[model samples]
Target: MSRQVTPRAAPFRQFIVKVHGRCNLACRYCYLYEGPDHTWRTRPAAAGPKVLDQTATRIAEHAARHTLTDLSLVLHGGEPLLAGAARLAAFAERVRERVPRGCVVHTTVQTNATLLDDRRLAMLARHGVTVGVSLDGGRAAHNTLRVDHAGRPSWPAAVRGARLLAERYPDAYAGILTVVDPASDPVETYESLLTLRPPALDLLLPHGNWTAPPPGLPGRGTSYGDWLCTVFDRWWSAGRRETRIRLFEECLALLLGLPAATESLGTEPFTAVVVETDGSIEQVDSLKSAYEGAARTGLDIFRHSFDQALNHPGVAARQTGIAALSAQCQACPLVAVCGGGHYAHRYRAGHGFTNPSVYCTDLQRFIRHVASRLRESAALTSGGATR
Candidate 1:
């Protein structure tokens, strides 16, 4: 008998095109701006016509070659709205027009909500592009770090934008993306976000690695995990799904032996890649949090195919699944569910990305807690069936 082996490379399905290189607000903890990488400083402010055209062509070529049925076009940036809503819609149209006819393109813009106005939301909705907003949390106090160039708080404007999207353009309101802040009250943070009426939620851990540990990460404690578990309990005991909390739902799916993957977990191959503002093909942008030039692949749309990028060392490493993990990770009981953590979280100054995640203890704690809840649920169902 022969064992099945995972492929060396998987075709890219999510194309993150950086439309703008500079942000309207100067977020204090933004990994792209404040992290070790300063590559954005040298790039064009907004992706030029040449860059966008060539990128669309390259994406079409990749999709045709792979005969892909679905692909995601993520119009990203330091703040994509700085490029103007019309320009973003036009760029999305270009990709949609260029892709193979059979390929369904799902276009989205990940923006900080301060720039979202009625006109922008209407234009995005008409163009079939959804909007995903980013925030630290729901309140002004939670977003003290998210301020404008002049140091004015963006919370008031953000609130207006979020409400407008939810009220007038609900279909285009994809979700709210908030980074986990262990310092805040987890349940309070979770409930406040619900008031915005987002269809879903994207909860991301702060991007950090061993050398540059995330803020508030205790030396030997699972504070981040504890925060997540509190939120999980709140969400679970609600007796009805309030909205899609991506991290929690994905973890449950993985625990149930269902096929699921996210940037944070599971053994599924990473199939997303980034196209920088200047047309440079790179690994996931989060790698910028690890080191200077950490995301670079030396490939560009004008000269290289997405297939060519599949051969890059960083991209290949992510697709290798469990084989890419450190020996300790391979030996761990929860390897399948945690997937050795996010690739960027495994970085150390000299050792590269072979180590387990910086949040190893936190992930272990969260996974076990979820597993216990699952068992309790199963027991309840069994008892009811017996009765």
Candidate 2:
């Protein structure tokens, strides 16, 4: 058994509320719906007013106790907009009204961009909610796997929604999120997304672990790392003024010995928590891709406080920093930078999460690549030349 590390007392600052439990589109690679966990099916399809009210109260209590100045409320779901714009807006307002004075809530809704129309965007904006859209890539061909339940392509509607946000509601446009597809041309993929004029980009790795490997991952291959490096070079070479890529930027920050935290990098405490539509409090949703019940905390807003959820073994494990890593991981030079490569990606069958990430080699390769670029840039600067 892995050693138990003392949990951090860090308060949760990011709350992902599952407003609706169902999605209109059935993307081929959706881990939450198709993964081992079936908890969503048992929960309410949408959060009833009662659940929302109690959840908001609980959130406020936690924030007040911790004296948090700023928090993030991400209205998430299989697709959050399915809960209706007015309902979502009202819920955001309620939460804002409930939070303690001076506690600023940064509200955002992560959607597939298929349901974002003029009316919906207007309502969300009025409620002070920003929009984050998920896309495989900007090109239609890049989004071939993102289809609706009827097996019809979602790119057309999705593109329209994205364009609408950029054109009419730029203030509400948070960014575009893309899951890296190693098969696609990395530079081309990055450039295509730039056409959407997103203020930022969130490039993510597909969720996977040793038990069930991610798509396109071979026995010993760094295809994913190679893909990331290709994009990193393009972004870095361009002076990185195109837009922010969260993953790459976080990597750079960690390498520079600065304080940074992301699911994919850094030793910062994981301060994000989730609230199911049925009022259950759980760990981050990414654990669903690891195994069944991987994210369950056996706690709910009705009977438990967010502080109690913080002590759950799963939640604590993530916040323990380098102590939660495996023997091999702890001995590694890149341990601090990678932070064991996301808590979920470290799971192995019988050993639980006490293992190095399945993406260990890939992380090493990518981290070194970024470090080398940083060194090159420093050298150029010292030599009185622009990189």
List the candidates' TM-scores in order. Answer: 0.97, 0.97
Candidate 2 Cα outliers beyond 4 Å, as residue runs: 1-7, 385-387
Score candidate 2 by lDDT.
Answer: 0.91
Best by TM-score: 1
- For model 1, the stretches where C-alpha displacement exceeds 4 angstroms are 1-7
lDDT per residue, candidate 1, 121-210, as tens digits?
999999999999998888889999999999999999999999999999999999999999998999989988999998899988899999
- Cα-based lDDT for every prediction: 0.91, 0.91
What's every prediction's RMSD, in angstroms?
Answer: 3.2, 3.0
Per-residue CA lDDT of candidate 2, range 1-387, in tens? 112323446889999999999999999889999899998988999999999999999989888878889899999999999999998889888888989999999999999999999999999998899999999998999999899999999999999999999999999999999998888999999999999999999988889998988876535889999999999999999999999999999999999999997998988989999999999999989999988888999999998889888878788877888988899999999988998997888888998989988888889999999999999989988888643
Candidate 2 has its poorest 10 consecutive residues by lDDT at 1-10
Clashes per candidate, residues 3 or more apart or on different chains: 0, 0
